[model samples]
Each structure stands twice: as C-alpha cells, then as structure tokens.
Target: MAGKTHDFLMVSKSILPEAILKTAKVKELLAQGEVYTIHEAVELVGLSRSAYYKYKDGVFPFYEASRERIITISLLLENKAGVLSHVLNFIASVKGNVLTINQGIPLQGVANVSISIETAGMADTPENLLAGLGEISGVRKIEVIGQT
Candidate 1:
C-alpha cells in the first residue's frame, strides 16, 4: 500500500466550493474576535460544525495564510552613535514593519543586534532587504535568524 501525498493549490474565490468558502468565513470570525464559539462562528457563516471542522484546517483566506510573513535578522553592527538608527531608517524606507529589536552590549567595538520585522508590506524581498542592509555603513554582517 502507498501512503497519501497531499498537494496544495491557489484558487480564486470565484471557483471555490461553498463549504471551503464558508470554512474560511468561520476562521475569519474567530480571528476577528467577532464570535466566541465554534458553533456561533459556524452558524454565522451558514456552515455546520462538522463541515467547519472538516475544512477549517485546510482552507484559509490568502491574507490569513500569508500573515506569518515575519522574519528575524541578526546583525553585527559597529558600536557607533548612529549605526542602529541608520539600519532602522533603511528598514522603514523599504516598508518593512519593525516589530521588535534587541541589542547586546558592545564588545570589541561591535554589537549584536536582532530585529524582527513583518515583511508583508515590504517593497523588497528578504534577500533584497538583506543586500540593502549590507550596503549600509557600519553594518558588519546580516543574516536571517528566523522566519515564519
């Protein structure tokens, strides 16, 4: 016997079957905190609980599915007065939303800085952003530490 292999596809809403679309609505209701329980959400979306449960894990709106567009980058920066600010400014210029930043104490004239950013609205791809960061003065190194 052979094991099942699952494949995924991106389909436009115009052709999606009703059950899958209703499942997406249920998820949206929960995410927006508009409904408290599965039953309420399923009812609001005109879907049965069983159907919601069946398709919930498999069907998602494009935005919901791609919402995990966050990345954390670690940088080796010169312990200079404006190096960190420059890095932040560059990120803003590229439309990257900065979520968190952590900087370690300077050691040997260098500091370790980690920045987490949401890249959904970024004008450049992750690689392009990294390349731009590398071009900034005093940014010694740049590498992606995490992504989700």
Candidate 2:
C-alpha cells in the first residue's frame, strides 16, 4: 500500500543477504562515478537492475548514514572584510564540515548567508554550534533553517 509504513533496523553487513549487499555495492559504484550507467553498475556488483532499484533507497553504508546528518544555518552578517572567513573558521574549530555557502548581496550594510554543514564529526551539538556562530564578531544573528 502507498501509505504503508516500514520498519528499519541497523544490521551488520556480514549477516545481510547477498542481494542486499550487492545492492549496496551497486550504489557505491554509481556514486563514485566508476560506472556511468545503472546497467554497468549492477553488472559490476553482480546484481540485477531491478533488485538494485528495490533496495537502493532503503540501503546505505553506516558511515554514509552517519555522515549525512547536515544542518542549514542562516546568518545575518555585517558587510565587512573577513567576516565570512571568521565564521567558517569558527565552524571548523568545532569540527563542522561545510558543504555549501550562499551569500546574498549586501543590503543596508548586512548580508544574508546560508550555509549547509555536515555535523557528524563535530565535537559539539547543533545548539552549541549555533551559539558559537552567534559569538563571532561580525555575526549579527543566526538561526537553523533546516536539517537532515
């Protein structure tokens, strides 16, 4: 059923069914750009395309799952030299990996900046990260816009 809910579990790869494991491998091939087409990837991983499609969305390597926890933060920054750089350095000090940064045109001495950061390796929680950003000299305001 379209509205059905599914239960998920974290299981060791050693105990995973061969087809599921192969599905993961196929996905890896595609993600790394080693194979241009699904046909090629599935063949390389010894899986059928149909099976790969079935499990691809459901299966992910544990490290990938952990690494994909990302947060988008919006900042109102003073339009001054090195402000963005300082903000980035602060995030790095907390072990946040910045994924994307978009800064809008300065308006009335302030610029809106949106940054997406991967927090898996961070030493602090998201709230602490926001607090740290807020403490930067040129940052006027900070808010979390999204997370996944």
Candidate 3:
C-alpha cells in the first residue's frame, strides 16, 4: 500500500449506494458501543459481513477523518434566552475545546452562530457532536463548515 496513489471525494449521502451507507452504519454501531462485534453490527444494519470487510477500511464519516483537528460548525438557533448557553454546555459535555465563537445578530427570530472547536480532546465524534446539538431545543440547523 505504500506506493499506491489515492483520491477522495465528499459526496452527498443521498447519492451513495445502499451497501456503502450500511457499511458506515455498521462501523458507527460498533464505534458507539451499540454492538460488540462486527457480525452483530453487520446484522443490525442489514449489511453483509463480506461487504463490511470490503469497505470498512475505506469508508468512514468525515468527522473520523478529521479527528485531532480543528473543526468549525455553523448553526442557526432560535433567538431566546439560554440557547447559546445550551450549545456551549453540550460542547463542553463532550470535551470539545472551544477556540472561538461568533454569533451574528438575530434576524427573523434566528441567530447565526459559528463555533471553532479543537477536536483533539473531544470524547465523541464530530458527527455525534452535531447530532446532539441538533437535538437541543433551540437549534434550527447545524453543519460542519470547515476543518483543519
């Protein structure tokens, strides 16, 4: 593998084949402690073990690739008391180190926020971080805007 050349692309999940998507799910299930073995994870996600093994080394969430780096997340939140606090608290809960935060003035009952976090110390994947943030009451939208 040392002399091999590789290329990569960031693709929308909607356009990916089912086997690839399920392979990712199987990996996630194992990573998140939802399943103890590859066999269990593959069965749970309805992915064949052979397919999982074929793609497992190559298929991973973008966040997994960005581990130990800095990531910026852009979010829109309802303009209300404690909304930003909740967001910050959630980041802290996952051991994410907040490097900078910028919140724009609210418009139409929503405020735009961008937070830069150092993921080296994060206890969870950025994918899970975004998911948890999305579940917060006032968060309108969330996405990873940049990473380094």
Q: Estimated TM-score per prediction?
A: 0.55, 0.55, 0.68
The C-alpha lDDT values of all candidates are: 0.85, 0.85, 0.92
Clashing pairs in 2: none
Rate residue 124 of model 1 by lDDT: 72
Q: Model 3 misses residue 29 by how many Å?
A: 9.5
CA RMSD for every model? 11.3, 12.2, 4.2
Q: What would the per-residue lDDT of candidate 3 be over residues 1-148, giving only the tens digit for each residue?
A: 7899655566799999999999999989998999899999988989899999999888988888778989899999999999999999999999999999999999999999999999997999888998999999999999788877
lDDT of 1 by residue, 64-140 (tens): 44344888899999999999999999999989999999999999999999999898877776667788999999999
Model 3: how far is 132 from its true place, Å?
Answer: 0.8
TM-score, cand. 2 vs. native = 0.55
Candidate 2, which ten residues in sequence have the lowest lDDT sum? 60-69
Task: Name the lDDT value of residue 59 in candidate 1.
Answer: 88
In candidate 3, stretches whose alpha carbon ends up further than 4 angstroms from where it belongs are 1-9, 18-58
Residue by residue across 1-148, what tens digits does model 2's lDDT show?
7989755565778999999999988888888899999999888878888898888889986546545488788999999999999999989998999999999999999999999999887887666778888988989999767667
